[model samples]
Target: MTATEFIKKVFFFEVLQGLALTFKHMVSPAVTRQYPTEKREPVPGSRGLHALVRDTETGKEKCVGCGLCAAMCPSQCIHIYTSEGEDHKKVVDRYEIEVLRCVFCALCVEACPFGAVALSEVFEYSGYTREEFYYTKEMLLENWDKNMAGEKGRIYFEKFWRPKTVDFGAPALVKTEERKTV
Candidate 1:
């Protein structure tokens, strides 16, 4: 062994360094939030539970029963049943979501053309039975009313859920080719 290695072994420099780190941490302030009494705000676009948006004018669900959300879901947790109405328009008979099976990917939100479905900020939902997690049309609408209504829902869609398309209300910046002089 070299002389430096011998000195380190005899003085236990590595052990002292480890203890110093431990002691430093012991004196440091606790970073953990008391989860029950104190809650941290969820970041924008953070996916949690699912909700169906309601049309403000009609006060009914905004879902047109297009089934795009179901088609886009990777987990296949969304289900929608639609039939012909008396006026020959499509009517949604049922809308169900297996919340337990949902992967919270938020693809359903992006696939919706009408901005009907949204992932709410509520992550505290818990239930003992599987049936409680099964959300129906009414339940989803209620979820929106409870957790994502008004300004909060609007901000969520505007900041996170809305798809960025070419016609998304922004002025296009087109570059023109310059003519070359001979």
Candidate 2:
């Protein structure tokens, strides 16, 4: 072995270097968050909990009982029941999401043509029992209500409502005047 290599091994240079680094970091500002007390802000477009959007004018849910969300769910955790109402409109009889089985892929949000379903930024949901995780329509609506209750909630909702510009490379799908005539 070279003289420098032998000297490094004999002096335990690597161990000393590691210790020096540890001591240096010990004096540095702590990066640890106090969690419950000091919660970090969720980034834009962050998907956490699920919620059902309500119509601003009528104060009614935007969901039209379309099962597109359930159909597009990869995990099949969404359950939606629809029936014809007295007003001749499809009524959402039941809407349930099994949170435990959900993969949080946000497919349901993307599939909802009416922008009814949205993933909220509230990720602190935890329960002692498995049954507690099963969120019903009322529970989901309540979640949305809680989110939209404050100014922060309004900002969050606005972020979701803002039009997003995404380009999916399928020119044939784009409807033009020529295509409309054809």
- In model 2, which runs have C-alpha deviations exceeding 4 angstroms? 2-10, 149-182
**Ten contiguous residues minimizing lDDT sum, candidate 1:** 173-182
For candidate 1, the per-residue lDDT at 21 reads 99
Q: What tens-digit string does per-residue lDDT give for candidate 1 at 1-182?
A: 99999999999989999999999999999999999799998765679899999888999998889999999999999999999998899898999999999999889999988889999888999989999999999999999999999988876776555644313355333333311110
- lDDT of the structure predicted as candidate 1: 0.85
For residue 102, give model 1's deviation from the true position in Å: 0.6
Number of clashing residue pairs, candidate 2: 0
* Candidate that would win on TM-score: 1
- The local distance difference test score of model 2 is 0.78
lDDT of 2 by residue, 61-154 (tens): 7788879899999999999998998979899989999999999999887777776787887889898999999999988888888774446444
Overall lDDT per candidate, in order of appearance: 0.85, 0.78
